[model samples]
Target: MNQANFDEARKAEANYHNELYSDHEILEPGTWMSKPVPIVMELLERILQHKDHVTVLDLGCGAGRNTIPLAVRLKGTNSRVVGIDLLEEAIEKLRENSNKYDVADVIEARKGDAEQVDILEDAYDYIAACGCLEHVSSEEAFIKVLERMKMGTRLGGIHCITMNTDIQEVERETGRALETLIELNLPTEKAFSILEEVYDGWNVLDRKTTLLSIDEEKYEKPSQFRCQSITFAVQKI
Candidate 1:
């Protein structure tokens, strides 16, 4: 698909999220996960060990799940995080939570597509785009966003990305598989193939590909689908 098509897909996804949040207050939130992913926090800790100041970008930062705690951890280090989400309510809720944690000064929130948001060259010190990439409707759009993120990171900068490589969706009532949105039907091998090219010069610190699932019923769906999640924490060369 072309850029225009990709833009339309993003708009549609944004509309979906807006509708999801329409029933409640921006700050009316529940836990998306039990806690911050330990590995992600560990990596951030290690990255901050040698830096006096850092700039972090948290893409698809839903409800400050990871953003708030990271800001608290990086407090007094002159570090700041800018969270970008397609849902305005998500960003607003993130901002509200940041204030509650007294990290409002360190966490800034923006409403926009993470892939389309502009950043200065070599700007971010660390980036996280967990549970986000599958939303990109086409391969071309995904590659463009990945390239942009790579270019925006400083040399030696680290990125933590998690993507659902291939997810077969089923109807709410029927277990039969249905087509996913646009070109998100990417298989596991294909997703890795793209990554092989995307991180050519970068060093992979940690990598894993597996089913993205939890035992919590709250996080379960009514449909029968298999989600292959790919995670990578890499440093720019």
Candidate 2:
């Protein structure tokens, strides 16, 4: 996507997320933000085995779905989870949810674009970017973000990422193909190739791709969305 197209798509995606965050309550059943991602929780357990006090960075964290739970798990320890999202509504909701869950002290919610945010080198013990990397403005930005994630992580730390690749969408009413709109959409094979290249020499603890299909409303139209969802976890050597 060019800069103009990328800006438009980014605006639309941010608006969609802002509306969702405004309309639904966190942890409400049946919603995408209903609960913390199971794989992230499982990975945290593994991290706890090695370190008691941890610092984590959660890119594209929406309304604290995973961030709040992470903070709750790390509560009473010298641990912090920094959650960043592009939508202001998501950041606001995340702060509210964190306070509601009594994990506010451990969570720092910030509004920022994941691709543009500055990640300090060797600053984080665990970094997660669930369903968010594909929103980057371009393929180059996506790869750059991964490089930053790698640099931000401390030795022996883990990075968990989940993103949709090879997205396909069609309007339900007209049965016409629609642009996926999100930036940085890549083929499944190419996405993995980039990940392997960026994370070369790192220990790939887990990697898998699953085909997913869902019906949802997009750009004010009913649509069917399909993609290969990639979940990868790696540890810094």
Candidate 3:
């Protein structure tokens, strides 16, 4: 999509969230996970090691699930954490939560897109992007964002990312007539193929396949739901 289209969609998303706050519980990150807290905490602890005076950035930091917690952890230290997302409401809610949860000063929330974020190169020690890549218009744009993140990080900086993977088995088992839905909305094995080919030098810390399931009610309709999961960390060269 063009910059104008990207920006307009982002603003609309922000407006939607701003007008609807309490109802924000419809769906969320890690909704598919049996134990999301532990998963997120594990990743945070691993990324925010004992580095003094480090800066961390969260791309697509929707509603501060990871942002607020990371800020709390980094508080009382020289470390700073910033969370950026396309939704104004997400950013606003994140800011309120930061204050309510007592990390407002440490965590700065902003409305931003990964493709257009402006930051100094090699300024951050750790960058995190959970459940975001698949939503981009294309894999090429996704990698471009990754490349920007890479440039925004210091040498040896860590990048934590989670993506939707191919889910043929789930589609078969669930009998979801969503193969086309999955293809159009979520990343596939081909997406990873592109990532592997493009970012050959990055280390793969952890890789896993997860089904996009929440509770016992597996979705089978033509919906906006993405249908797979993958998480891994890479160190910037």
**Best-performing candidate as measured by TM-score:** 2
Evaluate model 1: give its TM-score: 0.83
- For residues 1-237, write the lDDT of model 3, one tens digit per residue: 556655554444444445544344312533432123345556557665646566889887877767777787788886788889877777877887787878887997888867778967988888888866655666677778877887788877777778766533224455454423221133556766766766678776666666664322223332243357776677766
**TM-score for model 3?**
0.75
lDDT of 1: 0.75
TM-scores vs. true structure, each candidate: 0.83, 0.96, 0.75
Tens digit of per-residue lDDT, candidate 2, span 57-166: 99999998899889999999989999999888889999999989999899999999888898999999999999999998778888888998888999999999999999
Candidate 3 runs further than 4 Å off: 1-21, 24-40, 47-50, 167-187, 215-226
What's the distance in Å from true for residue 85, model 3? 0.7
Candidate 1 lDDT by residue in tens digits, 18-116: 554444333234533447766778878878787888899988887777888789888888888999887877887788888888998899899887668
In terms of lDDT, model 3 sits at 0.65
Clashing pairs in 3: 14-88
Evaluate candidate 2 by giving its C-alpha RMSD to the native, one decimal: 1.2
Q: Report the Cα lDDT for residue 77, model 3.
A: 84
In terms of lDDT, model 2 sits at 0.90
Off by over 4 Å in 1: 1-31, 171-174, 213-221
TM-score of 2: 0.96
* lDDT measured at residue 145 in model 2 versus the true structure, 0 to 100: 89
